[model samples]
Every structure is written in C-alpha cells, then in structure tokens.
Target chain A: MRTAAAIAALSALLAVFPFLATAPWVMTIALFTLMYAALASAWNLVGGYAGYPSLGHAAFFGLGAYTEALWFNHHGIGAGLTPFAVLPLVGLAVAAAGLPVAWIAMRTRADVFAIVTITLLFVAQTLAYNLRGITHGAQGVAMPVPDFAPATFERPFYYAMLALLVLALLLSHAVLRSRLGLALLAIRADEDKARGVGVPVGTAKLGAFALSVGITGMAGGVWAYYLSFIYPQFAVDPLVTVAMVLMVFLGGRGTLWGPVLGAFIVAPAQQYLAYQYGASQLYLLGYAALLVLVMLVLPRGVLPTLGDRYRSRQRRARTLRADVGTGVSADTGGDIAADVAGEQP
Target chain B: MSAPLLEVRGLARRFGGVAALDDCSLTVRRSTVTGLIGPNGSGKTTLFNVVTGYLRADAGQILLEGRRVARPDPARLYRRGLCRTFQQPRVFADLSVLENLLIASGRRRAALAGPRVRADDRDRAEALLAEFSLAGLADDPAEELSYGQRKLLEFAALLMSSPSLVLLDEPTAGVNPTMVRTMERHIRARHAAGTAFLVVEHDMNLVMRLCDPVVVMAGGRVIAQGPPGDVQADPLVLDAYLGG
Candidate 1:
C-alpha cells in the first residue's frame, strides 16, 4: 500500500514537473531519462531475472531504432501514425530478430553465453554500419518532425515519452508478479532442477529474451524519433550498452524500481560530466568506475542492500515489542541488555 | 508376471576405453518398487543416466511399454511419463517451496503468461505440500531448507509431474532417519497409488525394506536380478557387494 501511494505521488509529480512543462532542455532530459529507464527495465527481464547476462541487448535496441527510421524515411508511415500505433510493429520486428539469437545463446553456459551475446552486438553493429544504402549507415537517417495537429510540440513529446516509461514499468511489474516471473526465478536458481520439474528451460529463456528485446527495441524506436536522427553509432553504441547494463545492476538488478533510480542518477551524472569535462570518454570511464565500486561494496546492488537494512530494522523492532509484551525486563543485566540492544538496533 | 514397462536390451556405454555400462540389460515392471544396488563405481548412476537419456548409449535398445525409444531427449522422455530426482537434492534455490512444486507440476510454462496461477493448480499444489508435510515451508525459499527437507521437496516436486515412472537416484542419501522414514511412507503410499519407482540407493536396510525385487550391478553390468532374499543369497551378488 505504501509503495503504491509512493508510486502514485511520483507519477503525479512527473506528470506536472515545472521544468518539463517550461524548458526544452528539461524536456529533452526527461525524454532521455524515460527512455533509459524503459530500456534498463527491459534488460532486467533477461539479465536480472533469468540470470542470463546479455551484453548484446543493443542489437535489439538498434534493430528497433533502424526499423523505425527506415519505415519513417522510406515508407511515409510516420506521418499518419501515433507513437502507440508504431510501437507494436517495432516490437514485432525486434522480437523476431531476438528469437534466433536467444535460441542459440540459450543453449550455452554463463561466460560462453556472455561472449556469444557480445559477438552478436558486434555482428549487429557491423550489419548496420555496412548497410549504408538502406540505413544511411554512418551518416544516419533523419526523422521528419512528426505531424502533430499544431506542429510537433516538445511538451507533448516529453509527456508521450513519460507515458511510455510508465507503461514499461507497469508491464515489468505485471511480469514479475506473474507465474512466468516465478519460473524465470526458478531457472535462475537452477536450470537443471527447473528442467527436471518440467519448466521448459529453453522456452522460458527464449520468451524472456524476446520480451526483453522487444521492450528495449520499442524504447529505441521512440528515442530515435525523439532525437530526430538514427545512426549506426547511436543504435549499436558500446557506451549505451554499458550504461544500460550498469544502470540495471546498480539500481538493484531484479527490483523494479532499481533501474529507474539508476537511470535518474547515471543519466544526469553523464550529462554533468559531459558539461564539465567536454569529453564523453570521461563520462564512460567514470560510469565504469562507479559500476566497479558498486559491485565491490554492495554486490547485491544498492536497492537490495537498503531493503535488507529496512527488513533488519523491522525485525529488531518486532523483537523489542515482543519482549515488552512478554514482560521480559528491558535491562536486567548490563552486559546482556547492552548486547540485546546492540542486536536490536 | 506382465511384460515389463521398460526393457533395456544389451545397453552399453563407454567413456573412452573404460566401459561405464557394458551389455547392461534389465526389465522394470510397472507399479512396483525396484531397487538397483551396487558398490561405488559400479555403474548404477551411469546406467540410470543412459536409460533416462542424460547420456548416450554406445549400444542399446530401450523399449518403453514395448515401443523402441532411441536418442530420447530428456524433455521427450518427461513428456512420455518418465521423471527423475537427482542423487543430490536439486531444488530451485531462489524459488519458494510452492513455486518449486508449481515448476515441478508441469503447468508453469503455459500458465506462466497469465496474471495469476489458476485456482485449481494452486489448490493442487497446496494439497501436495500438505501431503508431503511441506505446507509450513510453502513460503520459504528452497535454499533455506535443510538437507532432509530438500530431499522431501525434491520428491514432492517429482510427484507434481504425476509421472508414470520415477527414477530416484539416491533418494535417501544424506537424509536424516526421521525424514527417511517419512520418505519410506510416502513412497509406499505413492506405490499404492500406481506409481512405479526405480530407486538407486546404497542403504541396504532401506533397499531390503522398501524394494520387492532387487537388481544388482557391478562394473557396468547386471550380475544378478531376483527377489531381495534370493538376490541377497546369490554368490555373485555377494562377490559384487563384498569382494570382487
């Protein structure tokens, strides 16, 4: 109930933030944050829940971005459609692309699977880079300003992006609460045991991979339009992939709010670094260092650590209340009472 | 009495030069508890793996209910009503006891896409948990379970599949005496309900008490097969168990 109330308040605030309503820079930042959060949440589906670390998620993101770009540039489809209408088509395309990659990679073990995924990112980037005639390759294709009734408005675009992010969060929440989520957790715990009990290990992995890819792809498609350009560099950028993975891990990998928190922190920090250093490389290096530090100090990630502390405090309080109710002397022996108090709080 | 549900004819498996299973043949009757006993390195587990399609056989024909099954995939075998538990109790560590049973119940895949587990499936899972005395631990993660609890959970998980045949690889191994007795009772009840069990165990007392007919193997080949009393008295079985 408290969580729901908090989410509700956060949504209300986001829906009517002063900067988002007034400033173009704020709107752009909002859009970027929303997209990053969505993509990170999507990555969490496979990497966090299924415990399959995929370094090549950019393949799907790039595929979606490129597909949308090509469709809008060549087919005259973007003029008539709403973002919602285009999203499903983008999702379908991305899922189709993800199927075979996941099918093959799902059979491999941990480190081997990570290597395979990385190889896929390279393969996908190469394809996008070389397909110049169709994709505009290094030059990138431009998305014509979307034809809103009163011309393309930045505020409306920001809100649309925000809505997409909210939808992604809700979808992620729904999945985690569903039976599929439980099965994925089981698979993460032990694939062989999961399989022995009749969990279709391959099918579950493929499904998670496809869903994760599709969600990330949809976000990518939206992001491309928001930026008004799509390039191979943007589509399959190693930096973007690293940021997504780090955000998910740092935010608290399997927790729903972790990635959102991660995006809010990391994206703004990257922007600040770019502003101060005038070097994108510095931002990447700093982000990498942050991830390494987070892994070293809080291996389960930030959210889980906080959650554990919160749980421990609650348990201590409960024990204290229980002792009071049982008429146990609060401070009988100095040493033992100190030890008990120490244990409690 | 009746034709065996599973018939292994000249089954053989080799690991490089060493024969893990050499000309191994056996018959497993339906609705009966059959014991496979051997000393360490006697190919009991190897033969189990071969029959269950975990390992490929060098030379063999495995007939399930009189139909030849070759190159049998584990999933296919499962679909064909063969289920197994490992020597070490293997439960999904991150999942709850109920979730483990649900995974084992073979309904998670199709039902997973839905918002919630079906009421009927949940009820069935709860009933199974109660029957196995795991109701209290339903919400606890499988990782928090004791070794004996894990073994019981494994058995409960296997039962969720409602398999026609169950291959228990050391079901009593590492289990406490109290849990072992509980497992024995559960096995008896399950056997009475028409489930066939092929148990691989080292505990002779358990083997003698639970199994009707026993099969003995040595160095990857069956040396003797008969009623427990007769097999125990056989000189070859004694040699395999006690000496050569």
Candidate 2:
C-alpha cells in the first residue's frame, strides 16, 4: 500500500515537473539528467547486477548515434520515417555487435572482462575516426532538422528523453524481479557457486549484456537526435562511459533506485559545475573529489548504505525486545510479513 | 547394494609435477551415503572437485548412471542432477537466505523468464529454512549469517535442487553439534528418498555415524574401501592416518 502510494506520488511529481520549469536552463538540465539516468540504469543491468564491469558502453552509444545520424544524412530514407523511427534498428545493430564481444569477454572473470570492454571502446572509436566514407572521417555529420517552431523544439526532445528514462527504469525493475536478475546477483556474489546451482551463467550474462547495450543504443539515438550533430569524439567519448559508471557507483550499483538517484544528483551537478567554471577540468576534479568522499563515507553507495543503517537500527530494537524476554519474537513470520517491511520492489 | 549412481574411473588430476588425484577411483551407489576420508592434501578434495567439475581430470571418465559425461563442467553437471556444497560455504552472500535456496531450485530459469517467483517455490524455500531452523533469519543477507549458519544454508540450497547425486564437501565442518545432527538427519531422509551422496569429511565420528561403504584415501590414491567397521580396522588405512 505504501509502495503504491509512493509510486503514485513519484509519478505525479514527474508528470508535473515540466509545467513547473519556467526557465529554459531547468528544462535543459532535466533533459541531461534523464539521459544520464537512462544510460546508468542500462549499465546497471550488466555492471551492477551481473557483476561485469563493462567500460565500453560508449561503443554502443556512439554506434547508435552514428547509425541514426548516418541514416538521416545520406540514406534518403528519412522522407517516410523520422530519425526516431530508426532507433530500434540502431539498438538491434548495437546489440548484435555487442553480443559476440560479451560472449567472449564473459568467459573471463573480474578485471579481465573489464579490459575486454575497454578494448571494444578503443576499437569503436578507431573505426569511427578511420571509416572515412561512412563516418565522414572525423568531420562528423549534421542531422537534418525536422520543421518545428524554434521555441518548441527543445520541449519535444525533453519529453522524449523523459520517456526513455522511464522506460529504462521500468526495464531495470523488471529484470531485477526476473530469474535472470536472481542469477546475475548469484553470479555477482559467487560465479562458481552460481554455476554449481544450475544457472547457465554464460548464456544469462550474454543476454544481460545484449539487453544493456540495446537500451544504451536507444538512449544514444535519442541523444543524437536531440543534439542534431555528431562527431567521433563527442559520440564515442570515453568520459561519457566513465561518467555513466561513476553515477552507478555513486548511487548504488545493484539497487533499482540507485542509478536514478545518482543521475538526479550527479548529472546536474556535473553540468552546472561545468557551466559555472567553463573548464572541463574543474568539473572532472570535483567529480573525482566527490567520488572519493562517497567511497570513504558510504562505500556501498548511497541507497545501500542508508539501507544498512536502517536495518541495523531495526535489529538493535528487535534485540532489546528479545533480551527483555518477551513472549513474542517480532522476527518470526512468513514472506508476506517480511516483504512488507523490507526494501520496496 | 544397488547399481552405482556415479562412478569415477581411473581419475587423475595433476598440478605441475604434483599428482593431486593419481589414478583415483570411487563409486557412489544409489540411495547410499558414501564417505571420502583422508588427511590434509591427501587428494580427497581434489577428487571431489574433479568429479563436481571445478577441476578437470587430467585423465579419467565420470559415469553417471550408465553414460559417460565427458569434459565435466559445473552447470552441465548440475543439470544432470549433480549438486555440491563447498568446503567453506559459498552461499550467495548478498542475497537473502530464502533467495539463496530459490535461486538453486529448478525454478530459477522459469522465474527469470517470467520475472515472477512461483508461490510453491517460495513455500518450499520457507519450509526448507524452517526445517533447518533458519526460518527466522530467512530474509537476512546470507553473509550476515554466522559461519555455521552459512554451512546450513549451503546444505539447504543443495537439497533445494532435488539433486540425484549430492557431493557434500564437509557439510558439518564448521557447524555446531545440533546442526551436525540436523544435517545428518536431512541426509538420511534424502537418501531414503532415492538420492545418492559422496561426502568428504574430516569428522570420523560423524562419518561412522552416517556413512556406509567407507572409502579411505592416502597420497592421492584410494587405499581401502569396505563397510565402516572393516575400513576402520584396515591396517593400511590406520597407517595412512597415524603414519605408522
């Protein structure tokens, strides 16, 4: 009951936020934050839950952007379909490219898997830079703008980004409740044990990797359309990958709300700080300092850290009651009683 | 007594020059509890690891029922009705105790696909937790449990799979006396239900209490095998232990 109420309240707030945003800056910041949230949530599927730290989501993101931008620029197929209409195919293309790499990389464990992803990122960036005919050889491409009133262009993109973020959030929530989600968590905790328990670890991981990159690809497509321009460096930036991972870690890696919380906090701070300082180095330095501080104070990330403190306090109270020799133990129960008081689904 | 459920034939595993399992062989009969006993570094754990697919045998074949299972791997072995607990409990520490059991259950794949936990599976998980005296702590993160409780969780999780063959690597090692009794009882109950066991243990008293057709190992070889009384009386087995 409480969860439903909370969800409804959150929905109400999100639905009304645009109306409350009187300034253009607020809308721009919201759009950027939502985009980060989508990317981070997508990363959470593999990196956070499956326990594969992929440093190469930028590959999929850049590829997705490139796919749409290239189609809009040269294909002449845009007359019947908007660039947004091609997002799913772009996502599929990215996922297809990601699948083989994820399959090979997942055979390894820990940091080695991360290295494989980093290799993919470099390979992608190199391809975008060198593939002169297709990618325009670092000259970048300008997306043909759709005819819209000048004042209304940003509003549509803002809502589109918001829809993407919501979709990502829902997808993450569903995965968490699925058998694959459970398997991923088991793998994260202990891969050998997970396999011993009958989880098809390799197959499950590849599926997660494909799903993660697919969502990231769609987000990238949306971002490219919003920008109306794409360059190899801007599309495939390593820093974009770094920021996505940083936000995941800062918010809470495995928890559903962690990435969203991180995006809401970190993304706007990053944009605002960069706007105020005008130097990328200052914002990067601030992000680094904040990450170090989070590591020191809340090593488990924000949501989990807070959850731990809350559960510990509850335990203390329960312990006191038990020590007093009460006839009833507050802890005894079935799943329903337990589920009600535990973390929201 | 019955046809062997699992047969390890001429199994040999080596690390560099050291033969961890040197042509070792053993059999686990259907519905029987078989014990693998050896001193430290005596290749007992190595043999277990090889059979359970954690370590690949250098030269050997593992036969389940009557068919050869080549190039053993944990997931494949598990789907073929083989499950195991580790020496130190390897429960999914981040998950709740109930969740640990649920993931190990056959319903994991379906649950993953549907994104829903079956009511019956949840009920079974709860029942297993209660039977193991861990029902109260069912929702607690597995790592928060005491070392002994973790062992119980691992054992409970193995049982949740309804495995035909269970390879318990010291199921009672770190657990208390009550837990040892509970585990022994659970093993016997499961054995009567037609499951087979190949247990590796250092606790002779527990071994004598539970296992039949005892197999003793020394220096990467099976030194003797017989009824518990006969194996206990074997001079070679005594010498292997006492270094006589």
For each of the candidates, what fraction of the native contacts does it recover? 0.65, 0.74
Q: B179-199, model 1: which lDDT tens digit per residue?
A: 889999999999999999999
Over B1-244, each residue of candidate 2 has an lDDT whose tens digit, in order, gives 5557999889998899898888898888888899889888999889878888898888988998867888788877887899888898898988998999888875534446765466777888898888888999998889889888898888888777778999999988877898788778888888888888899998999899889989999889899998999999999999999998
Candidate 1's C-alpha lDDT? Answer: 0.82
In the predicted model 2, the residue pairs found to clash are: A179-B111, A179-B112, A180-B112
| Candidate 1 chain B weakest lDDT stretch, 10 residues | B107-116
**How many angstroms is the interface RMSD of candidate 1?**
2.2
TM-score of chain A, model number 1? 0.90
Q: For every candidate structure, what is the RMSD over all alpha carbons to the true structure, in angstroms?
A: 2.8, 4.8
Question: For this target, which candidate reaches the highest DockQ against the unseen true structure?
Answer: 1
lDDT of 1 at A117: 91
